[model samples]
Target: MDVTFGFLLLFVATFLVAGLVKGVTGMGLPTVAVGMLGSAVSPVTAAAMLVIPSLVTNVWQLLNGPSLGALLRRLWPMMLAILLGTVASTALLVEGDSRWSGMALGGALVAYAAYALLSPSTSVPGRWERPLAPLVGLVTGVLTGATGVFTLPAVPWLQSLRLPRDVLVQALGLAFTVSTVALALGLGRLGEFRLGQLGWSTAGIVPALVGMALGQAVRSRISQQRFRQFFLAFLILLGLELAIRALL
Candidate 1:
């Protein structure tokens, strides 16, 4: 895709919205970006564009966590599963393909949106982690590899783990960072990565960061429940639109 001025603006705007959503809700950047931009361009392109900013933000999250050592010790199995799943899925599905990949990405978005809007619950028993970690990791990793959105079961599932607030946030960051790195490697292996796309993705971080800052400034003013409702509704529409486009 030639990076036209109009599309460039649209791309930046999308990231701004994504960043703001993340600021308000602690998630949604990848879901929003992939769902909206994937419809406009190829999902592959959208996924590629997300690499830098997403990685940077998640890395910040990963670095800020004080309990990294413990989290790593407890989370290694799940992380390893995620890596395996991502590598396998990306190798098989994402490279050298755009049409079916778009369809699948759209489907994943729709499913995730539906889950968020309908059965939203935040709490996971820590006891369940022993059995569910690998399963969650595999699913999330596959989703990350294919659609560049890894939060579906991961975020809510982690929330269910009911870790301390700070630890949960950091854990989510580590999960995202791991998935992002895996996806980056997968894209690189498939030769889908380009210097131009990397440049654009990196440049996009500025608007995203700016939007996050603005969102933080105003987050206290808005009703978080209502904001989440609206955000999920938007995601549903975006996901459906992309799914329809994929069929066409």
Candidate 2:
């Protein structure tokens, strides 16, 4: 596709916003970026462009956390399952229509955001975590493959674990990093992720990093609860717009 000035501007703006969200909340980079760009580009293209930024940012997030080895030991099954599930479902990216992808993305976003807003006090029992982890990973991987959004059950399930704040953030980083890599590999196998696309994706890292820095700078000043509410509300509106446009 031709990368016009307008498109480049849109690309930068999209990632900047996405990175800011991630910086503030320690997640949402792919979800916000893909959802915003899906209207202007193919879902495949949007997902492709986000590869570098999402991977880089999430890896940074992952490494910054305290308990890498333990988290990996505990979460490996789920992480491996996510990889398998994403690879298994990648054909859908090639075969699915844009409208279907849009609807699915919209639905995933709305469902996740709505569930988050409800803030249910649900927690997974210790006995169930082992079995449930793989199931959640597989389902999240499928959704990530189909829609390029990995927040739904994955984020919610992670929250249920009730890890300490910093550990939870790091865990999110690890999960998102895995999801981003899986999506990149899936796109690469289909020949949808090209050198030219990688160039653009690489360029996005600058804006994304800048946005993240800015967000982090201001993070302490704002009420995280209020900001999250606003963010989730914005997602619901964006998701509704995408779904409505696809259906019409």
Top model number, TM-score: 2
Put down candidate 2 lDDT per residue, 1-248, tens digits, no spaces: 77689887888899999888787777878867877787688778888889999999998889987999999999999999898888777778767765776677678768877877887455689999998899999998887777667775687688678676667778989999999899899988988899988998998998898887777666557664665566567667656855775785
Tens digit of lDDT per residue, candidate 1, span 92-211? 546445456556656766676677677656456667778889998998788667656676557656655656555765787788888888888888888877898898789879877777
For model 1, the superposed segments whose C-alpha errors exceed 4 Å read: 95-123, 164-166, 218-248
Candidate 2: segments with Cα more than 4 A from true spot: 98-116, 220-248
Residue range with the least summed lDDT across 10 consecutive positions in model 1:
92-101
TM for every model, in the order presented, reads: 0.78, 0.86
Global lDDT of each candidate: 0.72, 0.80
lDDT of 1 at 93: 46
Highest-lDDT candidate:
2
